[model samples]
Target: MITFSKDFLWGAAASAPQTEGAALVDGKSPTVWDKWFELEPELFYEGVGPEQTSNTYYQYKEDVALMKKMALNSYRTSISWARILPDGRAVNVKAVQFYRDYFQEMKSNGIEPIINLFHFDMPWWLMEKGGWETRESIEAFAFYAQVVFEQFGDIIKKWTTFNEPLVHVECGYLGEAHYPKVVDFTRAIQVGYHTLLAHAMAVNRYKNSKYNDGEIGIILNLSPVYPKSTHVEDKKAAHITDLIYIRSFLDTVVHGYFPEELIQLFKTHQLLPKVEEEDKEIFQRNIVDFLGVNYYQPLRVQRPKKEQFPAQFPSAFASHYDWPNKKINPYRGWEIYPEGIYDLGMRLKNEYKNISWYVSENGMGVSEEERFLDESGVVQDSYRIDFLKEHLIMLQKAISEGSNCFGYHMWTFVDCWSWLNAYKNRYGFYRIDLENQFKRSEKASSLWLKQVIVENGFPMTDERKG
Candidate 1:
């Protein structure tokens, strides 16, 4: 009974660094990820770095043809800042041509391109200059954004400013899992504020440009926070977690302000982010045109009973995150709550006036790809199909209840490199044989997705089983 509109965009998402090879070719400088791999390859899972991934950079024309076979009407890919601008200061002409050709090919193949400006791949030069912590890097990011808008604006209309800013803040700044390895909360907050400011500045710049029909927005990994227990302390902890994790960026981007709870929390902990009065007006004046919600999992939180961490713990949001023992997906080490998508959709509807939105990224990652394959190279990924079905059912329910979700684009198009996990956790509908020259084979989920897209709804048991 669940039916999507015929015009609903159905495609996959990817980033340049993950899908594109030729990392240093055509005047491209090294990104932080490349530098991180060079510094310590041991940090990544299975010792896989971002050298040559799915090789989409060279094979994009063939890849677009494959997308046509898959019946995708839209596709999402990021432009590498370092690829376009070797040092994040000057645009590389050859790199620009590569992207222009790539976008034009996608369009010629009847695919709408959703281009994101930044996606976790910071230029190494910028990282050396303090990355997001320094204002200079923020300015450089705005410049990069403006250059991309001016150059590719004619071909790409759907633009995402930044991909998963919270992940950038949490993983890089707080968790020490990503690059720059800062565990201090004060720096993390500052980085978050600067990222938001940069996004706003880029939005304003794009809005005033000649591409009047082009839309610019920010992509947030909005995981709804849930308390493990019904206790009042647990509830309060959940609220604070949501405030710091979700509302911190949501309030700034959607509502044009920071959450008062977050401000008070930072004040209480003596770890407030450095913000200027003038920057506040910049954010307030330039709200995004749309919101891209990347839902993967919900966060489980509980009250912290132990003493707070020392003030010098090198993360931005110090003494805040507390997690109680909860059920987790053993495959990916992430919580697997499906209802979180519904809760997030409702929250966005009630709080943000039902703004135009889309499920930008959502998928499950599996460590072992061989388990799903048969002798014929066919992968019966019923588990992945079930995962998508469950989440989409919840999404369909939300839509029926009046949530203004425009479309859904999964986390990836094909199995590509994850930042830290590298090639360990495969999350692609089309499997790429890494041992070979990255030959791709369509998995069972790819066909399932095609049917879903073509039919514009969930297939019945008889139709799906076939």
Candidate 2:
């Protein structure tokens, strides 16, 4: 019997390049995703690239119709930096018109758009100039942010400065998942710092814009860390990992400063990113209006006997392990921990000032979801429906205790291209039928969610069968 606020946002999210696949059409240039698939075709799942996607670029009208059918009141989508500025500085007039029309269409359908400025699809041209790691790129992003505010600030009431900046730094600099695959955490630190500075600048710009009442914030993937065991060593490991992974971004965005211990750890390794004195004050001045939290899985860490790689990344002092005998999502290979959602809510209530927040991206990604399709054109994705129910119940509990959350947007509106896994795991309320002209079909979860929105809660347990 979980209920939500009356104004709770019921919707889904998708990014520009992932869904809108007009790769190089009508003055649109390639993004890093396009160039990556070009350089490393084998890296993508089934050799699929960014160019072949859900074709929302042309099919936006039809898609908005589907959103209305699902009774969605909100939809989050990113404006493709590449589409907006093919060459990264000059605005493309045609793309501008396209977005204006698309957004207006959604509004006409009674769907409010939660627009994000950047969503990992960095313009390939921008990446060439040292993307986010250089001060020049930071300034470039701030300028682009200003342009977005000036152009769409009136039509779009809700805006996100950047979506998951940490993922960009981790994948691009520390991990090998993204383009320009490198493993230098020193460089990762620099990218992370510059991104925060960029976000602060954007927040400041938004406050000063003509549409000052419009909401602008940044989205973060805040997966909490847990100790593998009660041992002191394991607890220490979890704390260190939390400081690096979660607090490094959260503290700065909320409190306007990095975790002091994290900075000291970096200093011990002589790996701190170059910081300017004025930049510190900038963050202190412009904290976010709201927080967009994307939680998928929590990390469990165990203390290592010694430094695993002192010569490698700056914070490689701990080891991460899986929760013992944890229930797992067989499709995406992530642990199923619904309680983590509740824990996150309580953390915000107790510690993070209970600032307004939303479950911006929390959905299961499954493989070969089309197998469950019936003759009537519905994919019987009962697994996804159950997954949402479990998480939403926790969210309901959080709300009952006052977490200041107002929305819950599933990861995507339609199945779109993932970074490295491409189309391997499908996470959409609607199915993407590749063989039948990129068709979009309804899934069981969409119908179930529609009812949840209609009721503003999961039906009582006895009525669930109804």
Candidate 3:
């Protein structure tokens, strides 16, 4: 049997900006998403924006009830910075009460809440003030963290400073798929540096605050890098990709320092962000207590095909390679590699002091899932069940071999809006009917997961063991 610890957390994760529909209600200000959509509605998928999501702000009670129905012991969600501090100045009393009541509901339902302070939803005012590119913006974020910790720290014991800070840097600054759409490498590095500094500052605040009993962490979307071939050039390309994408943030948050190679490389390229003298001390002193890993796919890279790609950032050193025999999620185009989970676990155990962590986000996203709905109106998503089971088998093997993994939380509980893609891909245990009155229904995977949670694992059949 593939067994997990009795205390293992079994749940799902969602974010306020993705799940909450009241974008403009109760003194909430616009996030960068709202502003971006307003500026260029055509850029988003089918005119869908962040304005109307799953409507969890009002239906949080129903959402909690659904979580209980799925037998979830824990649930991870983010507090919208814009919702709480709409103007980026003072507290919004109504927003505070709303979150307090929502969290209290989760606690009452036997659900442990893992709350994240930021999830790429920068308040428009803060973004206008230069976002994370400026030290002033970093300071504002730390202050906002202090405020959130002060208000809800007593209820939510598990906290995450940011969800996928790298995505914020890459998508917004480098890729132009997200808001502000700047493709400058220098600005991207600065934004990434300041964001990490913000995380460290928040960790410092939470550790020193009265809520020290609670554990604090950061969610990183870590992809294990692989070389395209055994050639020295390919290996070198993979190592550089690992340093830039993985170690840059992972090392600093866990080991209290940046990778020396990364620093030197950035310095050589004149891409280093401005650093204050006291920042190093703060980072060393405020290392995260735990980590939340959002693993979707591994990276495969080879030596740069040309001297300089259009991006001229990491592409200058490495080029992405499509593995010949890789399985893929056709709907989303992400490589589906279950073994990568095991690889990540072993890497953490061996190199990172065996830090306590959890699978904060892992799930299969399918496009137009309604095509698979059964006659009873439920989504018969057996593909998701198979996906989860395959990943769990690998995860169980990792834990058996001594990885300090504590839990598994899927990408989301209900279908929620994804940035730019909007609802193009559905990744949820409960299918939210956008065409209807935002009604939610269960998928086959939710039922399968409920049983797995009840048993603390699944039976290891011959096929699974193989």
Q: Please provide the root mean square deviation of candidate 1 (C-alpha atoms, Å).
A: 2.4
Clashing pairs in 2: none
- What candidate 3 gets wrong by more than 4 Å, as runs, is 308-311, 462-466
Each candidate structure's TM-score, on Cα atoms with residue i matched to residue i, is 0.95, 0.97, 0.98
Of 1 and 2, the candidate ahead on TM-score is: 2
> How many times do residue backbones clash in model 3?
0
Superposed by TM-score, candidate 2 places the C-alpha of residue 254 at a distance from the truth, in angstroms, of 1.2
lDDT of 3: 0.91
Instruction: Summarize candidate 2's per-residue lDDT along 1-466 as a digit string, tens digits.
Output: 6888788898998888788888899998888888988888988888888888899889899999999999999999999877877776789889889999999999999999999988888788888888777788877788788878888887998999888888989988998888778899789989889999999998988899887777888899988788988989888888888888889988888888888999888888777889887998999999988888898988888986457534366346678686778989887889888889889988878888888889899989999876888889788888888889889998888888888899999988888888788888999998887765368888888988999999888755623411
Lowest summed lDDT across 10 adjacent residues in model 3 is found at 457-466
Candidate 2 overall lDDT versus native:
0.86
Best by TM-score: 3
For all predictions, the C-alpha RMSD in Å is: 2.4, 1.6, 2.0
lDDT, candidate 1, 1-466, per-residue tens: 6678778888889899999978788888999999899999998887888985999888898889989999999998899999998976778999888899999999999999999998999999888889999888767888888899889899999999999998888889887888888787789888988899899988888888877587888899998877767888778777877788888888888889888877777787887877777987898998878898999887776666554643444222213343554445578888666788898889888999898888999998887888878888977888778778878888887888888888888878889988888888888888888786458888888888888887788744424631
